[model samples]
Target chain A: MTDAVERIVNLALHLAHAAKPVGHESIRRDVFGYPKDQDEAAYLRMFERDKDELRAAGFVIEANEAGLYSLDSAATFVSDVGLSATEIAAVRAAGTAALSDPSFPFAPELRLALAKLASRFEPLEVPAASRQADESPSDQAENAAALELATRASKRVEFVYTNSIGRTAAHTVEPYGLFLRDGRWYMVGRDIAHDEPRVYTVARMADLMVSGARPKSPDFSRPAGFDVSAFIRLPFQYGDQEFSAALRFDQSAAWRAKGLASGLGVLRSEGDETVWSVPARDDAALLRWVVENGPGISVDAPTELADRLVSTMRKAATLHG
Target chain B: MAKTPASERARRLLAVIARLESGSEIPLVDLAAELDASPTELASDLETLSLCGVAPFTPDEMIDVFVVDGMVEVYSPLPALDRPVRLSMTEARALAAALQGAGFSADDSLVQRLEAATAREFDAAQAERIVRAASGQHAKGVYGSLAAAAGAHRVVTIDYESAGGAGTSREIEPHVLFAERGAWYVAAHCRLAGAERTFRVDRIRSAQENGESFTVDAADAAPRTATPSGDLPTARVRFDAAGDFSARDWPGARLVSEHPAESGDGDIAGPKAVLGPLEIEIPYAGTDWIARRVVARGGAVEVLSPPDVRAAVVAVAESYSG
Candidate 1:
């Protein structure tokens, strides 16, 4: 098998560097990997499979009408697109950091990508970034596998999910997309039994398995206009009913609203305070979020929410008093 | 040696050919580091590549890659494969993920620029939409600037919004940039504080390089623990079982003890099984931050000791209640 890898690589190099299309006899005689004891038919079969693998790896191997093979340099090779120093630094910094992070799902591909771009610039002195806090190696592997299957293979997956309340159940999901939030991976998919979209934390999944029905073809199609970003909501946006809510950041803390809001809702400035109009699905959670992020932030609308805040705070103060 | 998958080795071999085609001699150690392989393994791969050649099988037609005197040297131009191959679907996705993890958006200029080097048939937009790593919109530009500054060891002045809601300007020497919990942070020596502090990249409202550079001291570059130091004041707080709390929420907090729910304990009512209230001792440098966390949980959490912290929590809760 190792020799097969070498043989395939040797065949690719032979064809790519050939001055003109060379026939099977020439390849068999010259390329080092082809087994000398193999008969002509078996040798040809191996050659055809090698070529297909190379093509699948993004190489363009053209077979001329005369049955000779040659490399299409224009299609096979990447042309130089001038990248600014900053762009190179950006890629190198992020790419290097990601490569060292085991939790990052794309480490192997990222390593190859960085290798391709290695000659572009001198390596930056960026240190390796830390992995997500509290992530175990096993969880990282399973999460990466689940994400790979969900996004690239478009496969359905089955897992026993333990929800926040510790209730465990088996679920078969046609995973549509995946996103990273707060260093945790979440898969948004259609639940087979409920026939509705739901988000499941990858860490809470157990005995996860991707459908083996068709390895090459996707098991299900993502609904049209289904964007995973829409599913990644704030801490306060997780209930059945959603309503408009307004929170105000005092003048002193106004600068923090944009970054804290994370582009979720519209933020406007009136006088000195910054008012953010965002969607709220859980009033208790919203109040908690306000208190959690507050010193200068407070609820500004929906009299009921404001009253709840007041009552909750009164209870908190009395508890401490 | 761990067995290298045939497909992965094949891809790596192509990249090796492309890397060596430039005709410059690269040290085997350096090349192995770049390719994420060990030197011995790379040397073996080079030996394997040396036997590959075109139709003639003559010395001139054979691949001329070799490792000599600790350096990889290529004498013959590999021709068609001399240039890098197009970015495969996986490689393209990796690039997008890396950039997005660094806070760049799918439509970021760097993404668009790199997209040109991808295979024409690859659907980058679709791939970007499928896997999102973007956590913050404003952090992208800030991250780029800080990265370059850290690489150059330059002093940068930044407008930072602290966790307590106060905004201040600090000129610091950037040492290392790291990510934890989906946010990027830079550990640097703050001239104002005369100590090394980690600042979240997203909280930096603006950054500008001050042109002056400083050398990083060995101590300054040492890894800083996320936990608060022992000298900081500790606050004892009781978290009701109804509230979802974990040790991770407080970096330096330790669980003191657990008090089982009494028959009439009203705080323990919830659908989930309630174990009781948790007594956690949390260390803090300032009262405001811890107060906000306690008040944010409504009455589920109570500050149990250190009268100042309790007063701070009461003041914060009362400020909103009034």
Candidate 2:
């Protein structure tokens, strides 16, 4: 491992410093720690490994059949993120808020990256604001790391995943991006088996491995104009269809209900109860909310939903009985 | 998993070079410590520096490395190496999502800063989609003040409405303000209850910061202990496979056991166990909280014990008519 790292470092420097594209013969002669003379196989293996590592690190090391290597001119390090002092503070504060959530997997990398960026400016006071919500804990460190790696490398990943329905299966996907929605991390990618795009909840995944065993070779390319959000279809979409559902929250749970309904649908107050009308598409979601809030909330409209709720309640009552 | 020394060293070497290119003379020890390396590794890095530079490889063109006494001076003057690197699109996207998740609107100052700081042209639509809140985005002023109070450790009187629709005034020493499921909450010491509490910030009607300050101990502010007093009364329930994920959302909820799938009943009228059963224990302040939940979920869950909880659930379920 040490030798591999050292070779990559040396090769990167050699390519970076070259006035012109450095040929393989020149690299072998000038760069130290190359295979001792007459071991062509070992030298080629080491060279390929170094090239891959450097490319993965964001160095655009170009090579051809003739073994000429050059760093992409535009790929050199630049000092200007163009952030003002206030911008740095904002980024720092955002980072701090993210770190406060114990389940965030990328905290270490975030801290190191932010420190480097902030070192350019005088330390700024982190704006005191509310920390981010700690959602239900999800142990997804390995998945998170794998997604990060594949996303950066533009490579594919293979993983064994279990869906909510309890079906576990293996899949290979070309990762487009990773996103967070509703406090959950999701990976948007193209499923190889299905030959179409899919969104995966990171928490539901297990045994993730990034593809592209060889360096500088990507397993797949993201489709043109691929939108991560466009491909994602959440299983439950309230009020997305023809069902217009109205729920009434009595005074007892009105305040908390309003908080829950903050920006979702039209809410109005009538006497002590708050009446909300939403296009109820999923029964389970609303049911969960109503059940959690106790008797203070009721489905007043869409008799079908109300009937379902009552029947569901009756089923639950039998369990306790 | 632990990072391999090779990968760790590669990361540090890249970071060190990038830092030095910012025209800063970094102290050898400070740089080494930041990289989690020893002075010996720093020397090795300097030795490696001798081999790097752009074309012609002349002394002047190469990165000059000097460790005089304790300071490491590096001069490359490489245009490629001089500037602060742009935020990678992934990093920018993640930051944007987190900032938005914390309830910052597109017009918030921090959001504006983020837009300004991002040097590359990010897809505005993509970024918007990533950060858009599904619901319960906070009112900016209320969120900001509470956050400030918590950071400053100020005791403040707040008019808060409880889940049961009761409003009360209490002096709370704000320790931490966080969001959970799009709702903002402040974990604090409530003087009225004389116990630690987590108050939903949005439900707080008004806040009057007291000039007085207080100290916060880590033990006192532990999140598990921050449950508001009213959510009392511990109850245990078993949820079939389909409901296991959501059941864990309850405060202080834990999985106690898992039961094999129960076969169907001979009678079609009776409830069928849809999925394998999972037994979970939860500490809840209100029986109504559990009762309503079980009633709503229908045959999916069952309150295993605590006759009072069972009765309450049965009552609520019987009250609802289709």
Candidate 3:
């Protein structure tokens, strides 16, 4: 492993720093330390293993049929997140805070990412803000790792997903990107079955298997211009069954309620009370939010949702009171 | 720092090479410190780079390096290697996500510059769609002022809407600004509360930098990996398998054990005998937060200790029909 590792590192560095792509003969003659000649079969096996290891190490090694290899050094090394000094400090602080939250699946990765950026910039002296301190860390390690591998390899993945409805089913997806939203991790990918972009919450996924795990990795590549943001949905934007729901907030909570309604739905203020007609993709979550705000918020439209909230509240009142 | 990953180290070395080739004769010690690597490891990396070059193996064609008295000089043998490293797709996405989440808008020139530098085209519209400013335009302006104050270590008076829905004015020493779950918050030392507090930025109605400055204790300023505040009351709860999913990310919460809830103990208010398999303990300052969560989970979880928490849950649940 050490020999393979060292040779591959030198080989990659050579290619990365080389004036041009080095052919197979030049790599064997220059990169390989042993001066003595070797059998072609053994050399091929070693070279193959070296290539795999390099790829696993996150190097994009491009090759031609003629065996000319070049390192995709540009893409392999830097990220153009383009954060300013202050923004970088903010990110580092957040990364530190995330590291504090033990449940964050990407803590180590986040640190390394931040460190890489820190190398180019100064480290922030003070801590920023921390989050997920009061939240449960998801038990989605397997799924998270699988999605990471798939994204790194630019390969498809197969997994068993237990959707919100609790129906566990198998899915094959072309992993595009991994995103953190609302304290949860989600994979934005193309669902091969649906032939459309889909967002799969990592916590809901199980038995994740990267397509690259197979011996003959597919020649599959992500579509050009694939953006993870397209698949990410906000809290209120989640759920397929979207409908208009209205809520009225009394003067007491009008300020916050008005803020929530901005850029989301129709809003009107009457004297002191504020009314909002919002597009709700998840009625239960929407209703729960209203109920949690207590007496100030009242459901006005979607009588069914209002009824459910009222009944749920009534049941709680009956049981707890 | 954890044991340095070889790949990451290699990339850093490459970055050093690029930086060196940019005609800056940086001292080896400073370079090592900048890359967060030991001087020895960096020296070794230089040794490795010395052996690598273009196809032909010749001294002149190889990367040349001179390390003398802890200073370093480098000359790249390969002209093609002089270009600055571009950000990888994943790296770009990670930064874009984090920065946008931190409130950098698509229209922000820095963000646009990053987009231009990205190895792959990241659609600004799509990126904006993923995470938008949680607060409105007015609140966003307020957030900017508060964040600036925090960065400058200034004391600011803010008209804030408290969690209980009351509006009040407070003077706080701005420490740090952070975003979580789409909401922006500033953790600061509140002169009014006489304690360090986390204030939601959106809830801040107005903010004015008093031009008064306050120095944060170094200990308090350092990035905290754990909750910075002092200890609080602890609550114990049992969660069913289904409940575990939702309970996992609960803040200040830890899974105490995975043992099934045993039958009734000597205590009159004991386990219901049919409790779930997972038991979690969370330290909290108050009951309102945990109570709301328990109510949300319905019957999947139950508070096992602190009668106050159970009572709080009951009170909140009862308010629905009140």
Candidate 4:
């Protein structure tokens, strides 16, 4: 119903007339997933519409009684053109998480939204946001059921929450939105208990069922002086705790950190190393940040944190040695 | 019950439409009888045909004309009809989704093959349009082709579906065939194995040479025969009250009673919440299924049924612990 239809049609016409006796059945099955006999009506209709559409679209579909419906290239609805089913899958796959879907709509959703904006797609070719790939068949079915439930009720959820790392926790949340980022999946919502907006990793969720409680989103006034732009760019979330610590990054790493700023850190430069006064509460998260920054960055303050960094570096060195 | 050549009739009628549009006219009685359509049906087809065109609004639409004095004598080349064979964006989306689900895509060479095959039936733009909107989960590659071969009594070579991906390729006499999740699979007698084996067509690496054919035994093609020993054990898990906190996480798991007499309140009322030391089983094959199921349950579900399966889940959980 969106832009994907138009683009795929163009692609299909190109495929149909690409070779001698174009194999339309392959299109129906590979592209359309319909059985050969089931698409008979389609074949009939093709005769009625081929010329005008083909010529206009530049596919040059001819009709012959050989090949699939025709062998003669001239008689087929499509003339010489190129590509295969797998290649098209690869192409169309980029837009939808269903192609590379892992779990949850975390970052993949952002990427899909950004990608869509970048492409300037024909509204008709706008494909459905793909589902995260790697879901077992039954999981897909469950997701479908969940989506349907969401569409029908327009409410929040109480689900056994599974973290991206496969840790399980239970949360009662108002389902606000669903998105896919990279290959990961996430569902954004207001945690009903906490009454704050939170995102749940979908693949981690076990007993997921959409709640029936319908709560209308209130009139939104952006929180006064809230930094929306900074929030959007920032990746990691700071929990209840905040840390004021200093980091010394080498010039090369500092330049990359300042320019990219993919995630956290209150970045500032001092001397040779850029002194980043980063805010991360606990040991687990702080450790993660340090590891990601690589060997160049060193924890200057908080001897415990610095020790952790040194120990981590020592482990890396041992491995390499 | 015969197929009664319904498809053939549908094919014939479409041909007549194509011929008429291409400026060929046929006698009414002859066309009607050939199509097995009654006089009224033929008249209806003609009436529908009368309305068919790019639309008389544009001079090009009015360019084609036909006169029915006594019988039906159609005339002139009608440009492609506006109401010609076309699919909606929704339909196309379903198709694409289905194909994608089945592991087919438009960029592959098959897309071109599909175009050529359906060319006689569909115009380039229309076909392309339909395919672009298409979405389905069906593997129409080697699997579908093999199934077709099996139906034709053709012996084909294919890898057997076993543990480590695909097995060695062997010549097989494919008999019974079925489709699972839009992919073709055939249960056939493998010459080497001398036993009936189910083969996934997509796993086949080479072209299926239509070897010396044989007859298919119709009686053996029943949908699901009872197994020799139907010992399909459902996977079960048991966890204490600590586990019950995360009970809702496991999909398809029904929390049974730790206490039969006492009732639960709210959603947990009437044994909705399985008490600690609970038992749950998920029916499936292989340890992978158990691992996935157990992992999904997280801290809530503990394995109780099928001791080996429980052990497998514990092992999988331990792997994650590291």
lDDT leader = 1
Candidate scoring better on DockQ of 2 and 4 = 2
Per residue, candidate 1 scores C-alpha lDDT tens digits across B238-296 of 88867666555666666677455334322222223334577778887567778988888
What is the per-residue lDDT of model 4 for residues B1-322, given as tens digits with 9 covering 90 to 100? 3432322222233334434543544557655643445666556546534443331225454223343552566456544421122222222232333333334444545443434323244333332321221222223345344534544567777644332222377888766544332223456778887876655444344436455887666644443211111344466566556554332333334445454533432222121344555554444434444443444344444565566665554444443232
In candidate 4, how many Å is residue B203 off?
Answer: 8.2
Leading candidate by TM-score: 1
Per-residue lDDT over B263-312 for candidate 2, one digit per residue giving the tens place of the 0 to 100 score: 33221111122345667677765565567666666777788879998997
Models, CA RMSD each: 4.5, 8.8, 8.0, 17.9
- 10 residues in a row with least lDDT, candidate 3 chain B: B264-273
Q: Which candidate tops DockQ?
A: 1
lDDT of 1 by residue, A1-321 (tens): 337767887777777777789888888887777788999899999889888878866687787899988887777777876776656766777877676666787777777777877755566666546455344534854575566656567788888999987899999998888887866788888999999999888878888888888689998888998788888888889899999999999987687788778768999999988999999999888988887766678888887898889998999999999
Displacement of the residue A33 alpha carbon in candidate 2, Å: 16
Ranking of all predicted structures according to TM-score, beginning with the best and ending with the worst: 1, 3, 2, 4
Candidate 1 docking class: medium
lDDT of each: 0.76, 0.61, 0.61, 0.42
Which tens-of-lDDT digit does each residue in B269-296 have in candidate 3?
Answer: 2112233467767666436656766765
lDDT of 3 by residue, A158-197 (tens): 8889886679999999877766656567787789899988
Output the chain A TM-score of model 2.
0.56
